[model samples]
Target: MLEEELVELRFRLGDGSDMGPIRYSSALTIAMLKERIVSEWPKDTKITPKGSTDLKLISSGKILENSQTIAQCRTPFSDLPGGLGSGGAGGGVITMHVVVQPSLTKTKTEKKVDDMPKKVTVCSCTIS
Candidate 1:
């Protein structure tokens, strides 16, 4: 797990909506966050969940790929409706979602395979 913490950025909707952005206080690592959300999202699927608090990650217009690398962290409300790269929000002052990316100081180790050869022995040879 990374040492960084993730927080959601909230924003208000349009059409006289009073709801702010729903963000998550990420107490998890970046890999865990991606794993939790990615597994539930289908390919080229847009999913919307009830309530602004819960983000379905994939929306109807969002395109997701298996080969794509998951960014450890995302800006607040980055996945919210009209949050990022959308003109619907009209470029207003939106709160930020702060997510912690995984640290790069971890070391990986590999185990070596045994070099012993297999031996076969038979007490007596049987002729069939």
Candidate 2:
């Protein structure tokens, strides 16, 4: 397998940020890409995904598998935008949509109650 066949990939996050125009070999796996995304994720984001399991990479309306390669995911030049490395050799940037689905450790009710102040007040009244 020739590693020279490089393809640029861009990951679009939920925050409307493009994570990469990073070059990857056609042989790179989707699982590997997820790992890269997790590592490159912005620290400033409030909600962080626990691991690669929390991520989903979609291309051409299809959710990519861990075993799948960049070559399998490559898109045609006409479909890519200029910023996604549409100029050079191999097919244009294989833009992938990233969906972060972090597992919820607590329920909605738990979150709501946790935010409430735990204070008690007593009122005494005299009636005639």
Candidate 3:
């Protein structure tokens, strides 16, 4: 039997930051990859992904399907996510863009703010 091939992939954030050239089996599904990304996201960042559902991965200008594998989503002779280097097939790395959807709570907060009165002041008066 042939050895299982391992591929490296990087997740690029909307802020232009790179997550990793994390290794995975060529057969790994997109859904599993997303889970890995969520777990690996930097805690230092202000934006935290609530879950995998709020994240989307894009490659070659296309959104990757959850059912697809690492091999299915990569391009040939591509460089690693953080300018690490370039390679082909087994050692090559694929870069995928991470898009974070806005939190639903933020929209609700905005609406509440909009509905509130714009101005409020207490007045002091003396009658003589």
How badly does each model clash, as a count of residue pairs? 8, 0, 0
Give the alpha carbon lDDT tens digit for every residue of 5-116 in model 1.
3344342222222223433334444334345443433334333222222332232334223233222223333566654423233423333222222223221111122344
Indicate the worst ten consecutive residues by lDDT in candidate 2. 83-92
lDDT of each: 0.34, 0.77, 0.77
**lDDT tens digits by residue: candidate 3, 30-127:** 89988988898998887888888778889878988899887777643345564323333545567789998855777789899999988979899999
Order of the predicted models by lDDT, top scorer first = 3, 2, 1
Model 2, position 1, has a per-residue lDDT of 81
CA displacement after TM-score superposition, residue 36 of candidate 2 (Å): 1.0
lDDT of 2 by residue, 58-119 (tens): 98789989998877666434455663334356455567899998646444566889999999
Task: Choose 1 or 3, whichever is better by lDDT.
Answer: 3
lDDT of 1 at 110: 16
Candidate 3 Cα outliers beyond 4 Å, as residue runs = 75-91, 102-128
Candidate that beats the other on lDDT, 2 or 3, i.e. the better one:
3
Give me the displacement of residue 81 in model 1, in angstroms: 21
Per-prediction CA RMSD (Å): 14.3, 6.8, 6.7
Ten residues in sequence with the least summed lDDT for candidate 3: 82-91
> Which residues of candidate 2, in runs, are more than 4 Å off?
1-3, 75-90, 103-128
TM-score (C-alpha) between model 3 and the true structure: 0.66
